[model samples]
Target: MIFSAGDGKESEPSTPLPPPYSGHNHVGDIEFHEILAGTDNFDESLVIGRGGFGKVYKGCINHGENLVVSAIKRLDPESSQGASEFWSEVQMLSRLRHCNIVSLIGYCTHEQEKILVYEYMPNGTLSDHLHKQGTPLSWFRRLNICIGAGLGLRYLHNDVGIDSGVIHRDFKSSNILLNESWESKISDFGLSKTCPTNQLSTHVNTLVKGTFGYLDPNYFRTGKLTRKSDVYAFGVVLLEVLCGKPALEELVDGEWRNLATWAQDSIKEGNLKNIIDSDIMGEISPKCLRKFVKMTERCLHDNTEQRPTMDAVVVTLKSVLALQEKLSMQAAGSRTIFGRMVDLLPFPTNGENSGRVEHNTLAPSKHGDGIVVAVKMLTSKTRQAYDKRQTKHIAELAHPNINIGGIFECRDSKHKYFNQLLFPNRGNFAEPLSWGTRLMIMIGVARGLTYLHLNKVHCDIRPSNILLDEEFNAKLEGITKTVTKETHISTWVRETMYYMAPEYFWNGDLSMKSDIYSFGVVLLESMTGRKAWVYGHIEKASLVDWASTVKSRIIYLKEIMDPRLNHNYPLQGAFECFDLVLRCIANESKDRPSSKEVLQTLERIYALNK
Candidate 1:
């Protein structure tokens, strides 16, 4: 039979599927021999699904004399975060040996590629069996899958091999794999982290990570991650199993809502008929459905602290299955954070990933290049600010010998997955710049600044608004540096605090001479390998003050050179740079050299090194 949509014509699937397995019927052989052997034999031809980090394939691995078929995941090298996630999964799964949890037999990272071997689940993923076009599972089996997955989660949260205090940041149906015996295993630990038990708010301040539909709204707003975040995600997954709907979708009202909200609204109105999956209609006992919904409601409670623990959730879900007891399932409709409605709402964008296959927009380059580039994508607010600044301020910019390259705004591209790129020759900070490169950085930055200051436009400078390419070349990356009218008193004061000339800090005014003062700070940072603000004994902090005091000591320069660059820095070059820095940071901004003179001096330094 075929399905039809609005057009009334038989609608074909966008993609076709490979034929089912014909060679091997043995579950163990399919897992161990053909798959886990970790060969090219098991490639995309056997792939079952693709996700943010990698693709999942079906194969078999050799288990001694016996062959076991299994599922293997391959991580793409170009994936923005593939390497870190691959190792994280290895660390979490390799040590864990449990019945309910999926077992990690072996892994391989060859030629900048990663592959994970796991025991094959003939029954496929829980999401597929629950929502896919296949034989509908009995309510008993569905509940069994839930309990089994919950057990696996409980073990991860506590019992596993160790109390590493693991937080499975991403938990959903697609991640739950099922075996022939119908037992479930929770997989995917890419976002998982091991933290200290003493930590109070499981919510750590981190960059926003996780899928759109499953992400904890609270965690997204505050950047604070907690175990309750997982509970919220699990609640969504439970609703998916119960209702058989995608997490988020555009409804008739034009508002995007997830399964949790839909289920909640239905439960409140006593409209289970419309909410429950048609396949399991009339089969699930009223008592079981009520209990299960209550379990989901507890998991979805807005107050993460008030939500049942994974341990409690497991017990409640199990009791629902066995005792068929009814639960009150009362959840306050209006939760705090009403103001965050705008944030919780999903916005349609060109490129969005939900731990699934990328849209395949960017094509890979055929030629090999030594250089790699990294670009950070900013929000619309940041972009708009940059645009306004670009037209008003053609800021004068120059600094030490750092080289700066052209500034370009990034747009969504097929090659650009997350609208960010951190490439290797495009810039290098992990390794120390060589002495020759250091001199080049100084001269180049000075030249860029010389052009800016000489341009007749007033410009304010800050170090963070600077850029360095792979060759240690520095350039000004700010939208504006020049000023015509009296700059805002507050804005000038803030800028001065970071790279202020002594006079500018005391009284908010900036000039070309003041630029020299900030340049001195940059020079010191490059020489000493210390950040502008290092946490000191108790009170004092400031890179310039620290460097000045250290420069007076006999052994100071040696102490400050980056260890990665080795100890063989030329003394004459060092003294020249130090003298240049001291001149720039002189008591008065007027005494500082013009960027033109600074460039001349750095050019001499660069020549000397060569």
Candidate 2:
């Protein structure tokens, strides 16, 4: 009665049905003609789910003497998910049976036709309910659904009674289905794989295949598949449920960002209330919210070994649910004061104003350990724009040289603000800097820019955007703007023309190289201690043009050095650094050195001089 997809070499012949279903039953084989009739010629009206694999159709089937509803999935022959994937699902679902796991009714294979049938889920997918359908789910409902899904995963990884564990390679909200009673069931086992049973090996090395935002970074990088991969994806789903946001969001500003990055940043800064779905805000107890956030953080640990098991996740979720239930029973008058603390913050006056930057001190140790932090309120308009601009780029661009900031929500105006580490002597670059200190700052800036470019395309690079700490270490702070490969330079060049490349100015093309051009201007300004543009006899003069003219005469390079240095600079390093600045500002965008190359050259110069 058991069916095998047949190891990609050949399709196994259809097997006969097992004796009347007890608890676990082999997947039944139905005729393709019957499947076609049930689906009504694969009509669009019957289609319920469409994906890369194919279309899922709602259909009716005869089980025993009674008619039953079922979901019929028809494979697209042209899809990359071929016979191997189709069979994989059939084999996996046949042996797995649980209340929270989708049930397989039967399958049909005739000639080239490959189809699967499953118990019909009347309410559709969790993704549909959470995002598409206007009916917002209550906090209680979301928590219950997550708990059920977690239990199902726990069974897959531990209680399945199988020596080799199951790893749901593609676990996300969309793969979770809801029956008529709104009971959650984990579905779509096509990408599921069995982990190694050997005691010595912890994971199975395999090809990396999963959704973009939900893919585990460790798995994606190392190609090691384990149960923890599912944990990472489930963590993303947890964030989606908590925030009521998509796993991957394309903001109004045209940048694609991950919700996990946004959630991590918000939680770290104790601004968890800001990112929560407005509908569920104040409904969750602060204690429960903190536990939920902590669970997500544990699940998303960069190291797979450090991530919690599905069993651990289920226990934590139950604890949170219990806390929520307890808080729900308490009278409003008797509710804990800590739960209402976030609501008592001052109203935010900074709404959509880019020019104004306000600093405030938050209450001590609300979420993280007791350490006072500084908060900078950004306008709601800015938050809306920033949310769309791939906040993950900022989160992932963590380095000693990068001024990474946390995000939070303002209680009064419901505006979101960034919480940055406080440093004394915060000011513009116009302040005096020694030649050695300037070189160190330039190198730091190059390293930070290099990291950003490796992870994302940062189009904004300028001296004003660079902040110096007490020790004069440069920390970059600016919007990490990302543009598509097809994005034209002219789209954003108008707003930042001073540091933009000449090619971008003329042809309207943008790339990572564009940032190098801007970096050149920053380097020139930092060297000469002058503004991007200065007044001359005729009109305004560009820093790039001035630097290029000075470089033409090697001797004038020293004269162009910042007057504040007072001829106390290292001559060899100064000349080499200026040479790099000239290369970065090349008129032909392609002629510019890459950020990595700039970092390497700067490091070599610094080492040689030191």
Candidate 3:
């Protein structure tokens, strides 16, 4: 409605001032003459805003040694309501100190001129940005601002260092001032009331007095003001921020509709898409959108008891922001990256396939208990986590190197997978592995790869995909399927392009030889304790080319091995392993040795170290 005429602007002009009345500028009286001189005797051009009380002006006043640019609010003496509000504002602001709440530099009371001086807000109010079409705020920025304001409101309701809690009688967008950085500062507090903390009943039986559209209906009906009334008003502001509409809008029929009523009505029918700000329609993910909309709806709930505490609201908003950021960082065409999706895939039915987990669990238990067990569902498709002693081995397949677990389905279409959480994991250079431990891991990896290449291809292979138990028994992980068609599957699996063989890169082939190529990358990573090179647009060479091209430059034997090993590794075996890695990462799949051959070579190298 453009209710406030405040249009704040510009800097403190470098001009001589006419003795600003020798008044202190720190939370005391700013002399009336100083304000007049600072605002050029209330010039029409300097007027920034207006309220029912009076106009607000941008003033440049000399305070002590420094000149400060401030927003000067001059109250009307004739209006009896404004007179009381002026005193209320001065009382509330003098002692209160919070970052999100605006800072009051000083006030003026000279024979009737009631003026408030505040730190200059350069970006003006949140209302101006949302409804008036100035700068477009991204969903991320909006979320942060809302969180900041929520924290401020929470402090007022509980954390304030006082005997009573504060209830902001008028909590709306216009009262939210945005600084140069767009941080939200809750401004107006003339109607704020302090509810006692020690009392059994927190409500104050005060006259109902808040803005029309944002006024709590319950407060109006019974003249009972509580903290929840402020929550209801804040809910209206949340809706305004999300939908980019005014709290009250006039329809074509000339009837006014409250934003909260319309949005809550749409949300009741399980729909918020229609009213969401079109500018940020696609920016909010489905998961984040559902969470945010539901929270906003609860904030507007009619029964005060049903509404969430400001603390819960703050936490939920933060989580929503966190989820949004994670999605933004997720690599394209991949459901999971690194170990993010590790605990979601199926648990192996046999011991041979139980080495690595392929999905992250819903909640990973922090206690370190060592046992490998598969999920047994007494009910259908239940995601229940049973750890350690409660789960037992039911697998017939046996291998000392392979982790064994069983998988059973009750009556559900989708099977539940569970396995032992390996303790003291030693992959990805978690800590440097000793020479003897390295040999054990290499041998296990070779045997596992040889077994897998017998039937299917492991699309993604990296150092992180290799898991080692406390005894250094290595097991392969990140495998999605025990078997798939040799060429392609129904769903596209995104493999790490950096570890991919040239044949797989160009021809889209997941041949058994591709496993050999990826194994080569893993082996190289182990020997050097460094990652295999990924191709980039600037440097188009693959790992094979780099290895083949730079082999002569890396002539010294010690230069190639990981220095963390302290040259403790057997020279001959280390030399042989390095050569083997070069052969596996060959440019052509045909040139790469078979998994069986790689395993045999690794076993031979293992024997040399002994």
lDDT of 2 by residue, 538-573 (tens): 334466666766767655666788776778767888
What overall lDDT goes with each candidate model?
0.60, 0.70, 0.67
lDDT of 3 by residue, 179-258 (tens): 88999899888778888766424898776678878988777777787888888888888898888888998877799988
lDDT of 1 by residue, 1-610 (tens): 0111223222222231222212212222123333434545656578877765668787666655756676787777665445556666666776566678787756665555567778888888888876667557765677788888888877776664333566777788888888889898988886786654444355555555677678877776666667778888888988887777767766676988767776788667534434666555534544455567877888888777777778888887888676432221111111111111212222222222222111111111111122222222223333344344443332222233222222222222322210021112335444455667666666766777777665542344554555554444555553333453344321212223445566554344667787788877777666665555444542234666656667777556676665655865677877888888888988677788888888888888777777
- lDDT over C-alpha atoms for residue 609 of model 3: 84
How far does residue 132 in candidate 2 sit from its true spot (Å)?
1.0
TM-scores of all models?
A: 0.46, 0.52, 0.52
Lowest summed lDDT window (length 10), candidate 1: 329-338
TM-score of candidate 3 relative to the true fold: 0.52
lDDT of prediction 2: 0.70
CA lDDT of 365 in candidate 1? 16
Error of 3 at 371 (Å): 50
Off by over 4 Å in 1: 1-44, 64-66, 161-163, 197-201, 250-256, 324-610
Backbone clashes in model 2, listed as residue pairs: 251-388, 352-379, 489-508, 489-509, 489-510, 490-508
Model 2 residue 550 CA deviation (Å) reads 40
Top model number, lDDT: 2
Q: Give me the displacement of residue 558 in model 2, in angstroms.
A: 47
